[model samples]
Target: MKMLLLRYSTAFICAVFIITGAVSGEDKAVGQTVSFRPDKIVTPVSSIIWKHRSSTGSVVKAIEWDVDDGDNIPNPRFKGITTLDQKTGEITITKLTVEHSGVYTIDINSKEHEQRFTLNVMERVPKPEITIEESSNPDVVYLRCAYSEKIIWKKSSGETLNGMKNQDPGEFITVKNTRNPENFYTCTLKNAVSEEISDPVTERELFGTGEDKAVGQTVSFRPDKIVPPVSSIIWKHRSSTGSVIKVIEWDAEDGDNIPNPRFKGITTLDEKTGEITITKLTVEHSGVYTIDINGKEHEQRFTLTVMERVSKPKMTIEVSSNPDVVYLRCAYSEKIIWKNSSGETLEGKKNHELGEFITVENTGNPENFYTCTLKNAVSEEISDPVSEREIFRTGEDKAVGQTVSFRPDKIVTPVSSIIWKHRSSTGSVVKAIEWDVDDGDNIPNPRFKGITTLDRKTGQITITNLIIEHSGVYTIDINSKEQEQRFTLTVMERVPKPKMTIEVSSNPDVAYLRCAYNEMIIWKNSSGETLNGTKNHDPGEYIMVKNTRNPENFYTCTLKNAVSEEISDPVTEREIFGTGSNAGMIVAIVIVVFIVIAVIAIVLSYLIMKTVHESVNNICPCIPNIFGPLDCLLKKTDREPKNSAPNDVASPLNETAP
Candidate 1:
């Protein structure tokens, strides 16, 4: 048995370390094998002695071994179960029982060694199972384990939790919802020697829903069909898993009785009406609540589901330019509605059910104000009103000395008259273009006379040769009626085609590039992917060449403005920094240096060999061994004497000591 343990000694120790943390005093379950190794010095001893000390300090000699003699077990209790190695002084005990737990020590020769071990033998832990107490709100729940020993809670996500306390000793633990219903939870019962984990439980398995209610809310169950002066009223609850418990019971003579402790203080029963009210609800209160009036069971029952309060939602706006449509989006997924200024629900305006957004057409009415309401079973919130002007105002940017057309949202054919008015930045309004069915087009302002034209049929106005002074809001009128949708334009100087300038910095691996424009610069590679380089004040940007890995890719800088954009000519890193020529030169220099080093090494080695050869020839010329300088010197002294040695060759003592 000792030999068998020795074969797998390394594996046994590793297993113990992984299970028990390899402490000096390790814990083990009953019916297991334990090896006590002498951690101190065990060598140069003529004999080895092992002893056991109990918890009461009583000591007994377990085993003794002699290097020359055999081994003996002094304690008969350890005779068949314990074994000690005579060579290594290691002790092994198999099939351990609780009585074998105590302090153990080994003695080298006669004196005890410093190394001491403690063994704890205990029974295996029993596997525990979890019990659940439901809550009215899914966010809070109570879980239970029955073990009184050390308890540990664990999430399936490998999250370690601090030690948890049981609300009722070893029975209940309050668990707040972490909003991760997919993650499962388990509890472990641990002691000094053993630990066992319970099966996992998830929120979905613990809670179910029907009619939802919020925590701290109240709910009533009524069964008033019985005649006045009812004899009994009983309210019973059945959990989703089919467990039945009494919520409240009342008898005309016995008064009221709330059997379950979970509903004691907060549950009420009205005798005359047979109505049961439960307030300050928790997730544990969620279940099917049924009532019986005057000893007669009512078929009607209520299934209550508890949930967290819904969050308030915010409304967002998105405007489509081409179709001129406004989208009102509520930031919530469900229970969304849109209302107008008169508080009338706009039905049929919902774009789709998947996305909580509704479309508002460009009705050209400034009074088109809308609000979105987001609601859940527990709460509702209405967004602030959004006006149509905020949604329908169209903005356009034009460059100076450029032509632009101001077209209405819709075309009005066979127009009687058309007028285009401009509101300048100073709030001054003027007619820029005017036309009538009886007369041709006319420009009212001298600055716009030769540059503006109005389309008589479509009521569209075109302004040519724009300048910075033309920047303002333009409103259109057709058939003597003004439209609500207006156009806001801003004119600025156009961006010039950027010129790329490159400057190599002191660092050989990087170069600085400048676009020579004041506008925003975007650097892009040949693949059009944006490049983020270190920013510089004057030289624009500092980009790495060698570290980029693709030094041959062409790069361009795009200068942009609200009105126009231009891109600089593409340039490669190699062209900017001349790294290609520099790399070739560096390679050539390294090759030359290596060649010089090789030639110098060869000459030095040849000189050293020549010097050694000359010294060997001067010391002894009769030696012919040249494989090594040392071999030649040793051979010269050990050469056989040619005059005599026939007897010396045959004698064993004459052979050289190797």
Candidate 2:
């Protein structure tokens, strides 16, 4: 029975041992799974350890943890798991940075088990530096804020900023704002982890404000503070209607934003240093401006004043022939006065009190100056002096037998009279003729021989039927000056009647006769009866005519003048028949010719003789004996007759002459 109890106990103990062993194996597996542990997490870096026992013995794998920041983190450098010694479960990370901070996961059996731990990176933003740009007027000032990182800008006044990224280095963010006589401005900058602010800056309004800004002058306003990155600075203007006029805007990284129409193409902004320049300012650009930085707002007002310049003045003076009449005119909006070289004002005229034009009369030998003074509400200017010289005496000279006239160089003054004085060749003054003279008793020259007459009121002297002896210089005293002019007389003889002659051609159709005086043809005739021709002939008609059947056929002209008259001897025409005709036929032809010539020859016989003589003179001397019909039949020439009749009378046609 004791042996049976021992067997049962052994069986019971064996079963218990098997059950305990299985439980222990399960605990060891659980312990192995929980063995990996991270003691400390370095920002951006994580570590993990793995413990596992194989069928032969226990083993350990040191693993590095993979970390990732959430949601599209840029610039991720380190990734994946790192392996360590298989015998040890120690894991560690050396480098710590912003990118190494996130959830980490382990990879096993194609499945991922993740462990998350956020690594918060602490970042500090430096204070931003602030600067203001100078403007033509102090009312407007440009502000700039600069920082190191992409920072946020906020205003204390609850103003939201348009966030900027990657602020450029060494660049200024600018804002255009107003400067108030008593106002302070403040700005602030902030980053994801840290924030900074600038000290308050104060500014005063410019003095003396108006619409008329002086050209070529400047006004400046500078703020005192350091600005921060991520902050925006703006320059704005508040209209009377309460509208905000944004002039300029500066971002932490981006340089500036200037509004159109106001600063477009007219303003310049610097990125290296925050500054703005507005060039060529005009009157229309003047206005109030506002400056906004962070959350602070400021205002400054300015007025421009302009000055005026004086214009030049002009003056003119006029004087009359009478020496007493004087006129002065000023062609300007100013006061004028007349003065003399003696430094005294003529006629006691006063400034601005004198008329624009003034006239003075009945004054003698007056010397004066014309002065014009121009003035405005602010200043006064004067014109150069205009002067007039004095004249003591003036008069005119007169000619005999001509109307007495006077041409004075200047206008005559009122109540002034001219005096006349006449002197003879004997140097004695003459006052007697048939006129009354206002002279101290005077005597006439002996050469005058009581033949001279003078009109005192008319200033005329008449010497009837002037002779050669009367030619001399006559003197007349006008005012205080003596004027002498000379005179000469000429005589002419009467002209005699002109003599005239007539000329006729055998053809009665070719030559023309005329009378002329001084080479001018006065009358002309072609046949015995007056022909249609002009007289007063030119020198070209003076020569004798050729190709005449009868040399005596006169082509005569007359010359006449007022002194004398001359006439050429009358020209006569002869008849001839050709040899082919008999005597009876020629005689019959001659009778017919005579009948036809009767109309031209009946007026004058002297004309016929003169024509015959001229015809004979034109023939060659060797042909002197040549008779009309006989010379033609014999073909022989004769010398001209030496003893020619003074007037060769034509044979009577009614009876034949032997």
Where's the lowest-lDDT run of ten residues in candidate 2?
A: 25-34
- Candidate 1 on 421-445: residue-level lDDT in tens? 9999999999998887788777888
Q: What is the model-wide C-alpha lDDT for candidate 1?
A: 0.75
Q: Per-prediction TM-score, please?
A: 0.42, 0.19
lDDT of each: 0.75, 0.42
Find the candidate with the highest lDDT and give its number.
Answer: 1
